[model samples]
Target: MTDIPLSTWAAMAEIIGAGSIITGLLVVLFQIRQFRVQQRNAVAINLAQTFYSPDLAQALSLMQNVPDGISLAEIRARGPEYEQAAITVCTSFETMGLLVHEKIAPMGLVLDLAGGIVSTMSRKLARWQEDLREEQQQPSWGEWFEWLGDQARAIKHEQPPAHIRLDQGAGGS
Candidate 1:
């Protein structure tokens, strides 16, 4: 066999080196995408856990009887427990709202999970939230919670309930 020229060998080596670099970069890009998906899934799981925690469940149970447009004074008049329940609910929604707003959690997932509850609770606590904000002189108080509630309400209006949406057996096995 004839010997290869040095210049030709150098060109072939450069092509191989470039191909290796491109392959490594593609691998890195894929890994980055996978990492992002894992991170988002982890966040979603944590949010779900928080939503279903015993404390939140208990708070929701307590607040279930709260009338729509309940006032802060009325909540305080009922007892400290009611007020505490309201705080728990508001803070939980606030966290969820912040997460959604920051895009750390997707809106579709959050709304699918707790949109109804958020809308209902927000309506029930609207007055109380406003009163608390005024009383505390903190305009940002419960801001995210209200935002989340608004988002939930808007989505609720725009889409049918899940049962209805799934009535067509879109995901039936």
Candidate 2:
């Protein structure tokens, strides 16, 4: 047998509206997180495809077979075949670095895929890369390769790789 005051009704409406706004914001944040996860997964899939490409596979094979710190002169003596393989591998790592910097690709996944490969290649090619930089008179060249190596070294992992964990997520990442 009582009627609520007009101001009380208005206050109640305001509280309900605030709750609704908070709920909406929460939803937006969740969706953004999910979108990032999906993007990371897509990037990982794209990376896998890149790895399986004929040229890339060949380049990777060459990289693995090459001894650490192999001299530029030796690589040149082996001829353009080795040169082309190094080019392919380094360029690929450069692209991966860009993706990681842009956050389009997950850092963890990038490291997981071939962290050691990149690190080792970058180290092996350090002298050659510097030579190219001097030859071109552009010190900025191959910065991406170095950047990717640094990113890879910065990540710490134990047991299975991060990509495996991402793939095994309850949902499709």
Candidate 3:
């Protein structure tokens, strides 16, 4: 101990401090990388799950059969199946919109899955929503539906969807 001067102790302390700083920085970098990997995994899992949902498939089928610009009365006359299918589609899109808006899910991913149908249905159902809102005395009942449609529309501006090639073999377009 007598051989070591105060200067040596001070130098040792500085080296220790520098080492700690470097270690802390490394830990932070590692954590960031871990978070990104988790996010990618999350996106992959969600994509697979959502794509395989029976409700989504049923909804798409209903959308194809249901004519555009039909009134709520027509849907009611068509019976519960029609109403249920439309509601299921809207509800799914609404949840998707909320997820994207809240950053719980990536917008591009959600759009890739259902953007076209979501936008079309929102437009088709605008009148129904308006009437329903008036009946309930709440104007915000289906705001998320509109938001999702609007966001999808904005994306169209960046890169026109028509440019996206559809593969008939894959059942696209």
- Clashing residue pairs, backbone N/CA/C < 3 A, model 2: none
Please, what is the whole-model Cα lDDT of each candidate in the order they appear?
Answer: 0.94, 0.80, 0.77
lDDT of 2 at 142: 77
For 30-74, candidate 1 gives per-residue lDDT tens digits of 999999999999988998899768888988998889899999999
Model 3: number of clashes?
A: 0
How would you encode candidate 2's per-residue C-alpha lDDT over 95-149 as one tens digit per residue? 9988888888877788878787787788777777777778779898778888897
**Maximum-TM-score candidate:** 1
Between prediction 1 and prediction 2, which has the larger lDDT? Answer: 1
Candidate 2 Cα outliers beyond 4 Å, as residue runs: 71-73, 150-173
* Ten contiguous residues with the weakest lDDT in model 3: 160-169
lDDT of 2 at 59: 78
lDDT of 3 at 78: 81
Tell me how candidate 1 scores on lDDT.
0.94
